[model samples]
Target: MKEKLARNINIYRKEKGLTQEELAQILGVSFQAVSKWENAQTMPDIALLPQLSRTLEVSIDKLLGYASQDRPITIYEEAYLTQDYYWGTEPNQACYQVLQRMPPTKPIKLLDIGCGEGKDAVFFARNGYEVTAFDVSDAGIEKTKRLADQIGVHVNVFKADILDYRLDQQFDVIFSSGVLHYIKPEFRQEIFDNYKQFTNPNGIHFLNVFVNKPFIAPPPEKEPNAYKWHSGELLAHYQDWFIQESSEIVFDCNSSGIPHKHAMTSLIAQKMTSLDH
Candidate 1:
């Protein structure tokens, strides 16, 4: 908790474009105090939490690494509120890959990050994997629950911002699609490290990101939070892991009722142990 709080403080402070001294001034604390809090050497007094939360524009629970019951933070929340699933009920092709490569011969644990409307997560759960999924949109989480309940499968779905959420438990497989771009380039290392650290050895991560290309125009759904990855940039983080499949593709889209194209890169990597030869 201390570590998460410290990291969140630093992240939010930077995101607000404030230096240590600047934030300290706003909170009426010495710059060293803020630094110590961010370094995990000290924690702010309980009384200061409210003020700190307001200043950072974050909820107190979030500052302490808990998922606050705040309203949805996703641009697709409106679309998801409708009865129809915004992204549809069909699971991504990567879901099939995970099923084949790491079938739940045992009670395999899997995580679906940013599982918009729960289709992929539900698919995994129905196929016998123990699945936990989360997204930043309340509607999305609710839709996921509805899907699982309707299918008679269980999926532990909740609302969480991918940028602030960290894995605290080990999982056998981690899956994400069309969501990595929500993480800014600067915070990718720390977030990815957390993901990799909490993954059991031999765990698999099937992730895809929209890559910025000169030829392909951006999609019609111009999301403010979206940050396109550089071509081959996603592969750099998995140098130590075995890359089973790494490729890029140009795809068509009509999400916003306007035709456009997007380039995306996908990677399927498996964690390796030092003993693996």
Candidate 2:
């Protein structure tokens, strides 16, 4: 079913002419995220439905990938997600520094794709941006919402699949961290085509994705194939957009003690003013 969803997302996004990296940026994720979605190895959480619908210019009902009258979110999962998503640390300094460099604008509207338990969203919201956060899980949304309420701040939360989401309005900035490596390729392109439309002409986009590398864990002696990886050179395809900064680094994820399994490449690109493309 997840694979079917990935295929459909790719078809619609390409009919529109978007690149995987482009889609990941708009969806506030990494190119790998779009790849994953296309491959059907996993699914986006449910709360991102609204944003996904708006971004993709599709209906929420269609985005959910469900035809039956069933709530996209499950109760048990919601309980678990809400608790787990928020149990992590605060926003990283590198992320904060990048966001602070943006030009000032009134009523700054921001979107956080794959916003987990609202950690990143809450950070931006508290710092004076109007934030809209979405995830694929209902539990995640509930947890984010509850946390926001406790903190006396407001963050619009929803369940959505970014690939199929549609939006008429644009944003001032879009942010996603450690999120895009999951998206499948076809859908990533769709997102790129739409991202420019979703942001103000000069809007800034911050993205983080994995750099291609070999696996670290001891091979099972008969381990399956490792995933293919990509780099900034591939991003050159979208040269029209000013590639502000693209770099590779290694960082610890959670307390795993293992050198990060995925080497990361981060991109900070500012949208080109002209839409003559």
Candidate 3:
């Protein structure tokens, strides 16, 4: 993992306004030890994990680079955390709000990146849309398939990295909620470029992602949260293929039930009828 553990730890520490020297003193370690840990040359021993976590003001799971949950639920916190309440309470309503608004005269073929737990997939498939779902986690893909089978719905599930995955088929709509924000900013433009190729004529794309608005704060940290985004920064990335249809930014909770009183932005854009890929 290229020693992301250390990198994550450093991110948390800096966010907490603690320097290596300061944190070292608190942990009863030399500044050099803290530096090595930050540099990924070494790791804190398991015995000191609890102390380290408390001193860092992060949960042990966060200190260890795992999800906040007791069990390592998903590799990424946003994956399941974003979906739990939405799925448990009003999954179909959530999907319908996005999908039904489209002009229904045409058949809809949909592609979902990071389709965790198949909540949205089930909603779409049951409503007679052809859906192709992708997730990087095998466990997620298995759960999607099982859910589809259980509901007597048909869906094609692919367990693959979204960054490397490509499709020969195009779709009338490509909807990825809580997935686009997870993409690192540098690669975001390239990722959107790929989406352009995936969209059929007159197709629409929907996205729900984090927005940077310091005035609207996020929930208390339970772990090393690696990414932050401003809505303006993220929208600039999609200007080429997405013309804003409808968008709203609101206070929302993150996947872990953390109070994310930040601007959660959602947009619906119709793909330009003609764009030479």
Say which candidate scores most in TM-score: 1
Better of 1 and 3 by lDDT: 1
Over 4 Å off in model 3, which ranges? 1-89, 92-94, 103-106, 220-226, 240-244, 254-258, 275-277
Best by lDDT: 1
Clash tally, candidates in order: 0, 51, 4
lDDT, candidate 3, 150-236, per-residue tens = 789999987655533545678887878766655655556656776877788667777777676767755564433235667566556
The C-alpha stretches of model 1 lying farther than 4 A from their native spots are 17-22, 66-72
Candidate 2 total steric clashes:
51
- Model 2 TM: 0.65
When sorted by TM-score, best at the front, the candidate numbers are 1, 2, 3
Worst 10 residues of 2 by lDDT: 218-227
**What C-alpha lDDT, on a 0 to 100 scale, does residue 133 get in candidate 3?**
91
Look at candidate 1 and tell me the lDDT of residue 253: 84
Task: Sort every candidate by lDDT, greatest first.
Answer: 1, 3, 2
